[model samples]
Target chain A: MTVGTKHTHLTYPDIDEAVDDDVRQHMEGMMEAEKGVLQAREQEMEECECKEGMFPNPTPGRRAFLLGAAAVAASTLPRGASASSGKAPAGAIEFDVPDDPTKVQGRLTNDDGGYGTRSQFESEARWRFPTKTKETSWTMTPLAESEGIITPSGLHFERHHGGIPTIDPKKHSLIVHGMCDNPKKYSMDDIRKFPSVSRQYFIECSGNGLTEFKAPFLKTVQGTHGLTSTSEWTGVMLSTILNEVGVQDGAAWILAEGADAAVMTRSVPLDKAWDDAMLIYAQNGEAMRPEQGYPLRVFLPGWEGNTHIKWLRRLEISDKPFMTREETSKYTDVVKDGKARQFSFTMEAKSVITFPSGEMKLPKPGFYEITGLAWSGRGKVRQVEVTTDGGKTWLIASLEGPIQSLCHTRFRIPWMWDGNPALIASRCIDETGYVQPTIAEINDVRGLNGHPKFASIYHLNGIMAWTIGADGTVTNAAHKV
Target chain B: MLIHWSKTVILAGSLVAFIAAAPASAQKFNFGTTPSAEEIAKIDIDAMPDGRGLPPGSGTPAMGKNIYANSCAACHGVNLEGVSAAGGAALVGGRGSIGTPKTKKTVESYWPYASTLFDYVRRAMPFDKPGSLSNDEIYAVSAYILNKGKIIGDKDVMNAKTLPKVDMPNKDGFIPDPRPDVFNYR
Candidate 1:
């Protein structure tokens, strides 16, 4: 079907098209009113075969499904909103579901043109941080609604310097030059020919919980610490490529540059490159998403997400750190001595109870899983300590198996909340013996800069406390502490 | 028959030599091609703090004013005050505000090297239209921001040599993080 020509508004009422229209409107500085939705509804009605179907029983086909879906939407949503509101999610599709699933034959295998979309009802998304522009913004994964350690590739948090670029693998090539003897450039096909390794790693923005530093600024756990995500990234080890390029003597640092509009650059230590870095082409068993740097990206395992340049196009080895805009002014931390800390790479051990996290209502609290994501950029999370009494006493939480180093480890503990007020929190202890400190403890050293208390925004791995109220409502206890 | 046997021996000998030299040279997997000079020039835009990789063009604040007004000032204010609605960071003031409550992270207060400004602008600036500025225009705009921030004089021209030489005020403000600053572990 032809899309809107004059306005380029969505002519189709599919979820992805609707989302694009919303983003397009947002980019044009137009707040979305119902004008576009109304136009969409009119177009949708013309294509819709609902006139062929009746209420309780009609032809068991697409027409009947649309009628049923509309009924469900009208009942579930507010006064004016209906199915033609067309806001399911970006990746979901309009599927025809029967009123009775057991009576009908299932959809044929490979019926969806060899690929499929998620259920329209299961609409969990990475909510974008309200930055002024969409180009240089970040999105937070719905961590509270998350399950398991491996964050679904679609739900992975993204931080884009410039907007995501659509790059073809055939056209894209990575040039490994400067301070290297060979100065070689590898295409995607060339790089794929080498023996590659797939390993799970979590990339956390050092500024993950920048809002929760001084006080609890945001309400949800997603708002507090949703800038981190884990995926089984697949690629040749950077050392393998480095070997092929042949590093010269005195090559201390390497500048990783992206192919995006910003051409994002960061100087990473050569040691880190040799240790665990990967020139990743695939993530979670598939090619990387455009938002996650399609075709190629430099994965500096466990480093700040910024240092892990997306859409990575160049690796220029150098003798000294190139004090780029990212390293020098932006990501540096202001410390206690009236000085700033630069190149603080490691995201220290951190954990939080996501189930009983902020803004979640514990319905008549009985047996609830006090679970959340625990991770350490330093190494594997050895133990996660859970505290329900405001850090007074701690208990060891059980970590779900397959705890990969530098990856998100899901930890769970059974909590019998007695419908009484309780402060629940979790702290991680990595293999390095570094325990995640309390917000107050973190503030004591890093928070107090001889002036009044305004905390440094990066590397906030402090224990996040969520207070369970007597009425079975969980809220942020960061401010209280 | 005799010629084939000699050729086989030479191939085997060369294979052995290739295996021996693997560690010393870059022959592992034997992948990738050497990028041409023009291809390298298109993307090799990073500038080192020691004035390396900088082009020869020079510019002054006066030369930069028109460029900044036309392209940059829409986002980064006309007077470098920063348009908050546009997400442009103020490059001028906030001289001694790092550790204070009113820490404003302007270039004057935070960025260590003047070369960073030149490199960043030339590679990625004007926010919306990155890499659109010429090296001369970038040098000029860098000088304009620096001049407004009180890092450079009105008359000083910014080339590769002079840009690196301009001592940023906060050069000594940054220190290496000696952390895991907290030791209490359970």
Candidate 2:
């Protein structure tokens, strides 16, 4: 099951060997492809079976449910009295109840041991952008549901040009060629053998808040700011590999290509490669997920997500940019004068309030802790400002938890709600001294040449505001400055 | 980690540490094998704007007509207008659309270099079956698309030299990214 001495021709024998014997047998019986084996393994992870009556799907709107329950209690029950008559209330366990905690017997340890499952209500999921095809679609990480800077590996956001490729680590080889003394190909095992280093960084899509260009189009923070996720990536530094191959003089850019269906390519700056660029094969604590480029991928901190080419198969160093279709026709930002901005790689500082955000209820708004995530690709967030009255006045929010460069930082501010309607928003200032601008401000500069509104959707790191209704409902405050 | 050493002692110790770490870092962590030329050529399909990696083949628009109709038209339209369901973008027209309200980005109007088309088609094309086109087919398709967009003559042949020479319409429509563009200087 080791990376070395395994299959080296895109076969899944090594992967099958690593998987459970029973699962492998089941997969083999079905004559599934390598992707099927991995998918089966995923299915096995979610094999928590429960009786139908035990956990019926909860109704959709939390506000409506809570408000309805409160109304029923006020109308039927005496003030400050319990809803129950000292017996088990409705929806409570009707079967034999074990009152003594020490005597109560939990589910016996079954054959399947050591695997875990999240509590039903504590489940985190990525929401997919509704596109025509799944192959070219993207899914947003639930930033609102995340606890700290590190996004759970399973809940990380995904953006694919030709869908996720089921690459066999044994078959994969990263070729370092073009403008080098030695053009060598490193196998998965060979790559692991190199002096490796791990560092936590955030990869954010330049189009993170594109939908909120003219207005707060998305209903939730996940939709507006979920295109970012942090991970402790482990791999050999790009400079180490470049030095190993002897990077030739005059080499300025490296054309990175993936092995996916699209063969996704981008021209990365050589300086960044020498600085902190990584040829990461492991994410979080294990091998990268298939969607995140299973076998290998290149990660450039403080750069756009597309530049971190996944399923990285080749590197061609050259003096100039390749100007591939990705850099020109796609990722380029078209502004005024009909001229497009090319190689606009860096994602600036941005922040968004997640708690008490859109579509959520304030149940009994008294002293609620308003919190959200803030990050800057340029560097660590220096400060975060929150405004409960739109942008009329802003107060510095306390940044909590670990603070790392190019990593998402959690910020919280204690807000006292007057129970009346109010507007809420947050903005970040990065260490580079760049402050997050408003949507109007961004458009003013880009549209100086009279470009239409929402013309350029990439890199819209504008402030987002949520309007809280008196009836305990929160919604997007579109066109808010 | 540097608590005990005095200023001069720390400087000397740091110098020693740097010297000690230098050779270890310089020592080759050699783990990969140098690929043979043949092996390298198998996947090195990037074509530079200056016609660096064009393959040894050529094709004309006449030769590419049938190939385009059979393989590319279903997604990229028979006239290269682009089919939405296929996710193929319109390959031609959109001339003079930049800076205007209705800016239509197409191969004829938006692409700055012609070699990019040859490179992209060879690497990924036909929507469903990419990397399936031959070198000659790629050249022929490039010629056909360019001709259809009126960027080149109908009978022109596309090759390493000719393809790079075919000046795209919007060659100067791009500008370098000027960052910190917003008025939020720290």
Q: What would the per-residue lDDT of candidate 2 be over residues A248-313, giving only the tens digit for each residue? A: 999999999999988999999999999999999899998888999878999999899999999999
Across B43-157, the per-residue lDDT of candidate 1 in tens digits comes to 8898888999888899999898999899989888889887767877778887887787656678888899988898888777777778888899999988888888888899999
Candidate 1 Cα misplacement greater than 4 A, ranges? A1-87, A448-454, A479-481, B1-27
Candidate 1 residue-wise lDDT, A1-481, digit = tens: 1111112232222222222222333333221222332243334435544422111111112333566556654453332212243445467654444445565555656766787777664545677776678888888887876789888889999998788988988998999899988888888999999879999999999889875666665666777788999999999889988888889999999999999988898999999999889988898988888888888888888889999888889999999999999999888888776698899998888887777675555556577778899999888999998888877898999999878899999999998888789988888999888888877777778754412222587888888888877766567677453
For every model shown, the clashing-pair count is 0, 3
TM-score of each: 0.84, 0.82
Tens-digit per-residue lDDT, B80-185, candidate 2: 9977656567799879876676566789989999988998898878768888999999999899999999999998999988999998999998899997789777
Residue pairs in candidate 1 whose N, alpha carbon or C atoms collide under 3 angstroms = none
Top TM-score model: 1
Please report, in order, the local distance difference test score of every candidate based on alpha carbons: 0.77, 0.76
DockQ of each: 0.44, 0.36
DockQ of 2: 0.36
